[model samples]
Target: MRFSMHSTLFDPDALPFRRALIAGIACVAAVVAGAMLADQPYLIFAGLAGLVYVGTLTVNCRALAWLVIALQPAALIVPFFPGRPFWWELCALLAWPSLLAYGLVNRRKIEVVAFDRAERWALAALGGYVAVILGTMAYRGVGLRIFGGEQMGGRVYVQQLVLSILPVLMLLAGFSQKQLRMAMITGWLLSLTYIVSELTFARSQDMAPLLYFFELPVDGLNFSTGYDASGVRRFGSLAAVAGAGLSLLWVAAPLRELLGRWLLVTGPLMVALVGLGLGSGYRNVFASAICTLFFLAWVQRFWNPSRVISMVLVGAVMVGGLYFFAKELPLSVQRSVSFFPGIAISPIAKADAATTNSDRVEVLKLAIADSPKYWLFGRGFGMDRFDRLPVDDPNDSVSMLYSQGMFYNGFLGTLLKLGVFGLLCSLLFVWHVSKIALQLGLLVRRRTPSEWSFFDRVCLLLCAQWFAAVLLFYLTNGDVTWWMQSFGLLAGLLMACRRLKQDEGFVVDSDGVPKASVTA
Candidate 1:
């Protein structure tokens, strides 16, 4: 493989045939070498697939961003590696270096957005929180490990932190708003596969064979099915709420534009998505979806007479249908609606809610009592020892402490893990982000619908609603890993939207429908 002095294999402008041939040969060699080294012929296929992926990434750096986005939900369902440092974690770790390499190769000037007062405060608070994390880690003598540890160890904490900050890095690395939107849409679509699988194959027995093919001997893939007191199966997914929010946004305008007058087909599909999400039997997910829909309705100005009548009709039909089938419906579906007035809740649903609420109250009490001890400084990340007791054991204080630290009960978790100082930092972070999101919302509200692109408007609405949901969930059902990453991404999108409005001059005439514009 003789090459010209000016033509290196890694050159972006290298000949296509030469590059492909060299890459193919290298890939084959790697596969053969790996198979020989491992003494496993099956390793060849894995090596080949990995090499191909890497080759594609080298050719298109943006694919790395897409991979990170797609892996959000995938890391939850697919058993890539058993324990810590899952596929998403690995991708996130790679993202920073990949972004840096791309920047170096392209020699593009990195654009820095000026931070406003709120942004500065948010950044400062985030830095303070991180400093506290480090201080605690050092005081506790916890070593930083990037891979393979117990569930709530330092590695997991650091990985979550990395995932949380990834979107900002992507934005700094020059990812465009259109690219992010496409990535999100792709992720949501991919998550639907897992959702559909869960819904269709409710029984573990039926899904066991399929899941087995994806699992390794060391993989601790959880295939447990959740059921309500009435023995009705509940279908939950890692991305259920987020997916539902995105689906609702799509249906609001994007889907309508894509499938004009094809309501018969797309309408049912959207309904199915919303229904599947609500079927998760999680009140938090249901609440988040409702909040998102409400925000969408308000932002889109659905108060027009025609839209009002349509919504009323739809609501009436849905309510009437549910009323008739309430008893026959799955308990999970019934529980989802149990919050509304005039809906009859089954005894099972009521008992289940009561029991769960009681347990949560107990956890909250424990968290409150123990929070004072860690008021000045937190117990530190990865301090929770799951091996102290069985995870399911109610007496497991360590497990409860872990949950509290991860924001299982929202701010209480922050208080427990990061102490009062950390709590303040978190509050500041949320406050500033909320302030920015609100300002953006109000800014968009003042503009005529035609002045702003539909994409930008939708992005703002979605981001705002997502952040609002984070606030709400923080009060109770906080999953820091998922929620923090979502917060970072949405925060980045909010910034991107602001940039489009201010920098790109995105304005369309009344006669011209809004289209997506690429942002630098």
Candidate 2:
């Protein structure tokens, strides 16, 4: 009898067995490879993990999303290989292709929604931003090699630009509100792990392995060694952003309801997470957390008489505590509060804060002074030999000022790299997304507490608050790439929410609450 490939291998009845056999074979191959690379244990384990991850993705493509979100914080801190693409960077590099393949295979099942007016504007702005990047590269004669270069060129800039927007994959993945909420929570918890580990290791002056493996070099300081005069450690990571934003959810009744009796622990948990985040000694994180909480309260309408009075009492008590214990507190805490006028803090904290402020001002001045030359078209991304001059060199300041400006100031940096046009594009992208958020906030306000599900409300609140905080960060501290990622996530959340609301088959009960819907 002639062997039929479809009947013998690809038949639906034989599919499960085939998958099992393939998995077994893969496991055996991994074992053999592990033996061969026993001396390089890290490489062997990484290979084995990759095999398992691929297998899981094949079984359920949705797992890819969970992994992406859950590993997001770790990605910032860990590297797949030394001094190479960070974990998050590698995820971005791999995610799009995997998503595309999944989409192509499941094309018939996937709904292709037309771009709405807001989405169109957002895309236009993004397109303009990309155009500016390319235009600058062409104008400056920079080669587009993304990896393995002593100097950062157009390729590095392009790579960062792509990675920043990769969170948009959440939109294409057709994630439900529940899935998004879970992923956000998972990411938040993972971020807390980082925060706790940092706090635990800081006292001993030993770096956590998670933070030590990559050692993201900023200026001359690594994450673990950066410290203040009072011996308070000061390390920065995107994890601080993620942890603080989600921790603010402790005040939400919807979240409380979802957690049931577990709600009792949320308040203290939030305090711990936020406190540890602040302990990282990044005032930007503290500022972002406060802004997020303010926005959350505003959106959630927590201005009721009792709530307002409670908030006032809490604020007063915090002020009193700080006033009494200012000198006794950790230097990081003192530094964080030093941004507020008349907040009593140690002299060391005050001096540190002033020094930081002075540095930022100098960088801003340099950026503004040089803005005229690259006003229309940017100097382009990457450093030249002159830009990389040693810090000790007397002549390096003026020569490297442009690159320093790009690194330190967000708005001015955009202008230097992509020019005025690119900055406008960036602003436009922010404007459109803010508009969408405003619209969503209005819609949420109109709904009763019962009408909205716990997951949907929390997801919307988290995204909105995080987006607002990122905007604040961009304006003050700079980090265009982080801003881009926040925008992408907010846009994706909005897209998913709109789809859920517009789906024809979705049902609502007499109380206006969604019934048996993905959102519900």
Candidate 3:
């Protein structure tokens, strides 16, 4: 192989990739899976990375994946404590510069025209975001309060912004095919492995595994009990399922036909879905599947009508078949079974057949009225509207709009962050990206060799995933683990994918790929 200087960067023999990641895994197993350590700093970083990419870690993504996996035990343990305050400081400070450096280096390797319009809009949009976020945070800082022993929480919040949001802007600066593939490979492999391992452990314990509507090896799960104090029937690992489920759906359209091409591709995922899907009891997962399937249908708009019709028909038949299955359960279990074929349209119910989302609706109403003269500009970035941020009558336009009105630069602040003309631009950018993924997904046949930008696919898929997740969160108000780590990860992945390459995927090879060597 001709050794271009850059070849070394991609070579598997050079960088200490495996060792670093193994060390990370060791940290996780020791810290998270086993016992509480005094506080390994790596555990915090690993958790943040895992949070940012619970779905994308694999040997190929980067050393970070191994680092995160090594730290997985800690990730499982993350909820036990408030993470130390300064975890993301490194990621925050390096955000934009690294993207710019890499983008500039690889600028000649890409077709920049795709993002020409998007870049122009985002640049203007970010200018506004800066003004609004800084201004709002500054203003709200006075009234914002942190929990006891958590006075440093604000710093953590801003640092998180850097780790997640800043990477987004940086990746957007270079929306290349190379980077996108990396993201996809990384997201798919790592997340899948984690799920498998977690499931294996859950089964070994004879515990109730919740994330799927399908089955896994749970020894002692009370299928008959709909609700338990521990929120029974909801898969335990699904705590991270939000990211995994959404990411999988992002690529669903493209992977849809590919699945049919070979049992190797289609059979495993289907079996996996059936085995894992019903166990979780997450309505968002259910809704994501429905919406993603529809989105893929829309993506395959030009495919043979017979194919599309067959899919729809098969889906209907399968769903209908499940209704009979639901009733076949012991009468006690059947009484608790109210998902899919039953409440397919609305996501308000749970495995126990009860509504669980009314609470988010109630909590979002706390912030009200267009108070600040700058209501149009919004309270600014990083403003926790949990204080008093509702901007309009509760009767008007759902909680997201209401919450955005009160805090997030309001409509004006939204404009400022996205620019007066750029909010739609950003929205369009998101929609446009999703559409591209759908198109590529539709065309991607198994083993046929997809020509779409690998990095772009990852970026686009992740964007779609986050778009769905954010949409669900905004629409229904799913809190708790929704934001804990996944939110930051999705945002960062979106940014990273936005700047991928043509053929080089995100996988870290057995070959040594160099570290982040570009001088920031």
True-structure lDDT of candidate 1: 0.57
Clashing pairs in 1: 410-474
Which of the two, 2 or 3, has more TM-score? Answer: 2
TM-score of each: 0.72, 0.75, 0.52
Ranking by TM-score: 2, 1, 3
TM-score of 3: 0.52
Q: Tens digit of lDDT per residue, candidate 2, span 273-340?
A: 56666655667666676677677767766557766686678668766876787778677767777887
Clashes of each: 1, 1, 70
Order by lDDT, highest first: 2, 1, 3
Please report, in order, the local distance difference test score of every candidate based on alpha carbons.
0.57, 0.61, 0.41
Runs of candidate 1 with Cα error greater than 4 angstroms are: 1-61, 75-80, 84-87, 102-108, 111-121, 141-152, 196-230, 238-242, 245-273, 301-325, 340-343, 384-408, 442-447, 450-454, 481-483, 506-520
Which prediction has the highest TM-score against the true structure?
2
What is the overall TM-score of model 2 with all chains considered together?
0.75
Worst 10 residues of 1 by lDDT: 213-222
Clashing pairs in 2: 75-88
Q: What tens digits encode model 3's per-residue C-alpha lDDT throughout 1-520?
A: 7766544544456465556666778887656744534556667666666655433322112333222322322222222323332213333333345444545555563344244333344434444434444554555452224443312225423542454344243334343444334444454444444355455544554443332212322222432243454344445344244445444544544554544565366645653453355455544445665555454434333346777686678667766765756544333223223544443322223433442334334434333223333434434333344333343454433454444332222233334322333344334444433443332333332123254434334444554455565465544543311232434444444434433321233222222121222233
